[model samples]
Target: MLQPKLKSKVRCTDRDIGEVTKVILDPLSHEISHIVVSMNGSGERQIEMAQVQDVMEDRVELRAPASAIAALPLFQRHDYVTTHEVEISHLEDNIDVTPGEVLVPFPDLEKDVKRRTFFMNFTHVIAFLIGLPMAYPILRFLMKPMYMPFDNDWLMVGNVSKIKQDDVGVQFQYMKKVKEAYMPEAEVEKSVWVLKASPEVLDKVYQDKDQEFRDASGRIIWINKKDFPYIAFSGKCPHLGCAFKWRQHKTLGQVFLCPCHLSIYDATGSVLDGPAPRALDALPIRVSAGGDVEIIDMEFKAGVKSQIRII
Candidate 1:
C-alpha cells in the first residue's frame, strides 16, 4: 500500500519543489492516484500518481524535473455533488474537496467546526457579562473620593452667651465629621480657642494687621465681612501646628501659649513673641439666632507667614 502523508516534502529529480497538501485517492479501489503539491510562491498543482517515483518516510520523490512541475496546470477543486447519483470513483477523479466542503466519508467535519466556533463566541459573551457586575463596584469604590463634595459645612462650636467678656480664651471641644480618602466618614474631636473681647480691645490688637483668609494655594476662601466681639481661633498654633492654651504669662498677663515652642499670643490671638511666623488662625464664625456660636471647622498649613487653609 502506497500511503503518502500530508506535509511530506515533494521533491523533483533536480531539487525540492514543494510539499504534499492533499492525497487524492481512487475511492472504488481505495488506492492513491494523485497528490496535490503546494508550491512555494507558485500556488498548488496536482501531480498524477504515475509521476511519483517513491514515497519515503518524510518526502515524496517525483520522476519529473522542477521545470516540468512548474509547467503543470494549477489544481482546481470542483463543487459538491449528491452521492446517490454520482459514482464515487468518478467524483474522486474529476472533483477535488477544498476547505469548508463536506466530504461524504467524514460528514461531521464541517458541522463540528461550525459548532466549535459558535461555542467559543458564546463563551466570550458569557464571561464578559459575569465580569461586568464584579468590576463596577470596585471602580465606584475607588472613584468615590474624587466625586465627594468638599467639607465646608458650619458646625456649632459653643454658645456665645456663655463666654464671659473678661474671658481671655476658652477652649471649646466639638465633634466634626471628616471624610478622608478611601476611609469611612468619621467624627473627630476638635477644639477651638474662643476669645470674647470688647470692640475697643479688638481694635487695639488687630488695628493695623492685614489678616487674609486664603487656602494653601493662595486662593481666598473666606473674607471677614462683619467683625463681632467674639472671635474663634483655631486651636492649632501658627508656627508648627502645636496645641496652644490660655494661661497667665509672667509679663503679658493673660495669653495663649504653645508649650512645644513657647509661641505666645495675647487675648486677641496676635503673635506676641517666639518663632511664630504669623498670628493664630481665626475660623469663620457667626452668632446664631439662639445665641449659639457656629463656626466653619477649618485647618491651615503651618510654618508659613500667610494663613493658608489646609481643609
Candidate 2:
C-alpha cells in the first residue's frame, strides 16, 4: 500500500482561483483577516485580499472564515501595489500592514473621479480660499445650541368656585391698536365684540362638548382648557352676517332667537330654526381663582357636522 499523503499548504494568485466556490474556501484553514474586492480603470475586476486563494489550480473544499471587507487606495489599483510590511498574528489571524495594505480598484469611482477632475480641482481651491473663512461663523450661529429663558411659562388652571350659574349674555371688546402716521392721532383702537358663554349656558356646553366658533372676519375660533372661565361664540348668522340673539320662546321658554333673519339658535349655539347654514360659533374660556372669568382666546367658527370653517 502507498504511504498516506499529508495535507500541505500551497501559495496561489487571485487568477488561479477560477471559480467563486474555490475563492470562498481558500482561506478556510487559515483565518481570513480581510476581504478586498474592487474593479480597475479598464473595468477589470481585482480581488486584492484573495490573491493567495485566486491562483489555486483546482477547487479546494473548505469552510469560510470570518473577515472584514476594506477599500484599497487609488494608486495601488493603477499600478502594481506591494505590501511593504505585513504583520499577521499567527494565533488570531489578525493582519496589520503598511500604507499600501491592499490594492483593489473600483472602476466606477475611477470613472467618476476622471469625469469631475476639472470641476473638483477648481472647487477645492475656491472652498479653501472662500468657504473655509465663513464656515466657522456660520456653524457657530446656526449649529450651536443656545439656552432659552423660562420666565414666561404659565401653569394650567385646575379648580375654581362657581358663583353665578345662569345663562347671562356677555360681550367684551377685542381691541387692536394701530399706529396712525400723518394725522394728529398717534394710535387708534379697533374694537371687535367677542361673545362669552354664561355659567348655566357653559354648563350645557360642557355637557355637549362642542368645539366650533368664528368671528366677523370669517376667522374660525377654538377653546382650550387654560385660564378661561367661559367661552363665547360669535352669535352672527353666516348666511347674511345677521346678529343671532337669544330670547325667551313662547312655548320653549329660555330659547335663543335671532332677530335679523328670524334665525334661531339653541342655548348651546346650535341653529334651531331659519335658513342658517350652521349653529352659533364657539368661543374659548378659562376659569379664574374665584370662578370669575377671562377670555384667553376664541375658538374659530365652524359649521355643524363638518370641521370646515372660516379659519
Candidate 3:
C-alpha cells in the first residue's frame, strides 16, 4: 500500500526540493523507509518517512522547515563503482567499503587502447629479434636457383617450324623460365639467332689446334647443332656482353656484328674478324617429338676464348 513512484514531487514547509529519484528501503526489513529527492537538477538528497507530513498522488509534504531540510546530512546514492569517477561521494557507508566488496569497474576505452598498443609493439620487437639471424640463410636459399647450371636450364624457344628456309639468320628474343623455392617462376629474356646448320662446324672450324673449346670430359658440350635441325646461337658478343645484330654487310653477308666494338661472327657462329676472344656461344637446343623447340638458356663469361659460366 506504500509503494512510491520515481519523479514524485517532494516539498518542505517553506520551499520545494525537486522529485523522488529512488525510494530507499531498509535492507533487513525490505520496507520502503525514505525517498531520494534531487535538488537544483544536480545533487541528490534523501528524506525520512518521519519527516513526511502527508503523501499525495503527485507530491509529498514535509514537516521540517526548508532550512532544516537543507541542513539534513547530504546524501549521494553510490552511483560509481570506481574511485576515479569525477565526482567523489562523501557518504559514511561508501567509506567503509573493503577491496573485496566492490563490483567490477566499468571498462575505459582510452586505457584499454594504450594497453593493447604497448603489447603489440612488444610482440613486434620480439618477432624481429627472433627473425634477424635467419636472413642470410634465407637469402642464400632464395638466390640458389639463379646460380643453377645455366647450360642445363632448358627453356622453350619456339615451334620447330618458326624458321623459314629462305630467311637468312632470322633473329628473335625469348623468355627463359627460372624456378626457385617459395617464389613464383620468373622469366629471363635473351636474344637468339635460330637457323639450320651442320653440326660438324664445331669440329671443323671452331675447334682450335688445342681444342680449347672442348671440356675436360672430351665431349663438345657447348656445340649443340649435332642432332637438331634448328640451332640457336647466343646473340651476346663474347667481347663484353654487348648485343649483336644479324646484319647483311656489303662483303661479309649475314654476320653477327656487335656495334660496340665491330666484332663479327659468321653464319656458323665462328669468329670471322674484329677483337672477339672466342666464337659465338651455342645454346643447347632440343626439338621435341611434338615439334616444340627448346633451348637451355645460359650465360657465359665474355672476353674469353673457352666457354665459361657466368650464371
| Candidate of highest TM-score | 1
List lDDT for all candidates, in order.
Answer: 0.75, 0.40, 0.66
> Could you give candidate 3's per-residue lDDT for residues 24-62 as a string of tens digits?
544334345677677766567777778888877778888
Candidate 2 structure quality by residue, lDDT tens digits, 1-311 = 11111121222222221222111112234433223323222222223333333323323222222121113232234432222222322322232222343322233444566659988998899888887777878766554333211112122222223323445444443443232223343433221123344555556656645453344444554445322335555545544655555467887666556676777767666667776677665544555656544443322343344434332
lDDT-wise, the better of 1 and 3 is 1
Q: Model 1 — which ten-residue stretch has the worst lDDT? A: 99-108
Better of 1 and 2 by TM-score: 1
TM-score of 1: 0.49
Error of 1 at 308 (Å): 1.4
TM-score of each: 0.49, 0.33, 0.44
How would the candidate models be sorted by TM-score, starting from the highest? 1, 3, 2
Give me the displacement of residue 213 in model 3, in angstroms: 11
- List candidate 1 segments past 4 Å from native: 1-149, 204-223
- Ten-residue region with minimum lDDT total, candidate 2: 1-10
Off by over 4 Å in 3: 1-151, 177-186, 198-228
* Preferred candidate (lDDT higher): 2 or 3: 3
